[model samples]
Target: MSFVKALIATWHLSILIMFHLSRMRDLKSFYLGYIKRHCQQDFPKQLSYNRFVERQTSVGVYLLLFLNLRCLGPCTGISFIDSTPLRACHIKRAHQHRSLKGWAQTGKSTLGWFYGFKLHLVINDRGEIITFRITHGATDDREPLKSEAFTNKLFGKLVADRGYISQDLFERLFIDDIHMITKRKRNMKNSLMHLHDKVLLRKRALIESVNDQLKNICQIEHTRHRSINNFCSNLLAGLIAYQALEKKPSLDLEHVVSTLKRA
Candidate 1:
């Protein structure tokens, strides 16, 4: 009846959350098949798919705030850090891509060259996400760690792969009371490390498991984004949905939780 009518902000967030959590692969199909068919009673005044696309930017800020305030987990002394590539398009199609042309870049990973951005994720031993940073695809894995605000909440021991190993980086974090432990590179000399650190370094795959769940289960990365705002909304919504997962990959830290708490 009225052109000015709009869905409530919470309703908008709920719909975005369902987009990533639902079985449907894309937002159009999910909105048309599921929400339009089964959710009309709950959202009778919802906008059409096209209009919803236009409204994504409105919720982008809200999604980020919700992530920082509600979805994120706390930093346990023992945490893991890792980076994953979020490809905007195949490397071959980089020249033709338009949606994220300037935003994305040509970067190299352990896998190879990809055209997109990088997601640096940090998680605690319990498989809970502590914080994250997104950067240009070419950004070094160690760059985010250089920021004080990024590592402020973290403490005690931080286990990471060799990619994060740098003498200066280690000393900087150590100055802030964050003891970073990583295996020395092939060219580096050996140094004495506690048995606990060695064991946790081997278990660094905990972050990998979280990465798998985020991309495969939570729909964290999709290549079909039509706009940068839409892409951000999708990623944030996926993280919110992930927070609802009952079971997450974790370590047997029951006995050590109290110990770390006191230390």
Candidate 2:
């Protein structure tokens, strides 16, 4: 296929994947039962399931990343950051899994230990994603904040869970003019927090709701991926799908703004 034709094919396949994910349909069934009949006019030529998968996987991560970025909602200065595990396979099959052999790792969360990657995400109080990064499960939550590239456009207060509470990380973000607010660990010293900050911290559950929507509504987590490329493609598609939702969890920004102003 010509370069332009290949690009179009990739884009069309991505749309199909997003459609599949958003509707929670079986991938193969969606392709055969719906896309082949209803979407035939869009394709230059018909493609078999295996060929379609091959072409879609070749579309590269950069394209999907671009699409994800394009769908991002505006930053509201108030942002929430969190990470969730993306398990590659059943723990029983971890030793036999080779598709993500070098890419995935074992990591522990509040729920427990799992073997896979971790998706670090930042979303505005509007419940729209600002940016995201994926890392090995073993990677520290505070590590991403160290990169200027990641925190470049992020400003105002960034809220996260206690896993992100580190004195060094807090100082680094403070130097960059981005205030880091996180819940204190039980053993840590009790420093006074602003009333505004404390209220926003109470609403950190908004991000958790976002995570639940991504996993359950958008189907970001699945063990049926056959290749790392497919795994990433599915994930990016799910993120894009979530972006298309008409309603999302959001904070009462008007109240937050007024409260901060009064204080």
Candidate 3:
């Protein structure tokens, strides 16, 4: 029956999420040694690890829906934006890497060249994810911002690092009533900013911290992916897992704002 199939799909999705949250890093060992040997009651009927992986692509839609409908937080006007590199493999291994060969590309970050994709994120002052996009490693950081739908829910001040400095992008977001704030490059000329804007810029590290949790805690990035589809499935499950976390990196905007005014 369709209902039975749906239930199985949900069960499979849960297991994938558990793998990301679990201390075990290897999905095979987690599914076989942990779930199969110990959690039989939790998953009464289970497929072999190979079969489950082959069909995990089925739950991809549900993962996206849950993240959009449940995990994502409301845009709170004040936001921080940044991008982090997701290296599929070391640059030295790019030539021989085949699993993500076509999907992932060689891209360079401040940390140096990496062979992978870029995850662009926008988070609010309370450190909740507002919007996110994944692009090939070579994609421009400013490309996603050009999409109206990508930033439709956002407004007010958006803080970013020096890498996001672009006049055209700034004017584009300005037209949408979303002001983009970034640290002025040493050679560039921009007028003095307001006290509130300057104070918020100091908190740009909040986005970087969020990125850290996504990689280190959620375990979104790893070099062990064998299939491109599973690679995506793992990523979505990781983001969903992050939403379940009780505490996330955040800012004390009220106190900071009041203190800035007093100064």
Q: Whose TM-score is greatest here?
A: 3
Residue 203 of model 2 has an lDDT of: 88
For 97-178, candidate 3 gives per-residue lDDT tens digits of 9998789999999999999999999999888989999999999888899998799989999998888888889998999999
> What's the C-alpha lDDT at position 62 in model 2?
53
Per-prediction TM-score: 0.93, 0.91, 0.96
Alpha-carbon shift of residue 184 in model 3 (angstroms): 0.3
Steric clash count of candidate 1: 0
> For candidate 2, what is the TM-score?
0.91
lDDT of 1 at 89: 89
Model 2 C-alpha lDDT versus the unseen true structure? 0.82
lDDT of 1 by residue, 21-75 (tens): 7756888998888898999889877788999888887888889998999889998
Order of the predicted models by TM-score, top scorer first: 3, 1, 2
- Winner on lDDT (1 vs 3): 3
Better of 2 and 3 by lDDT: 3
Q: Cα deviation in Å at residue 232, candidate 3?
A: 0.7
**In candidate 2, what are the lDDT values of residues 1-263, reduced to their tens digit?**
59877667665556655664546455777777777888777664668878877766766565575665578776778999999999998767888988889888988888888899999999998899888888999999888888887888799989999899888888889988899898888898898998989989988999999999898888888888778898887888788878878899999988877877887
lDDT of 1 at 228: 92
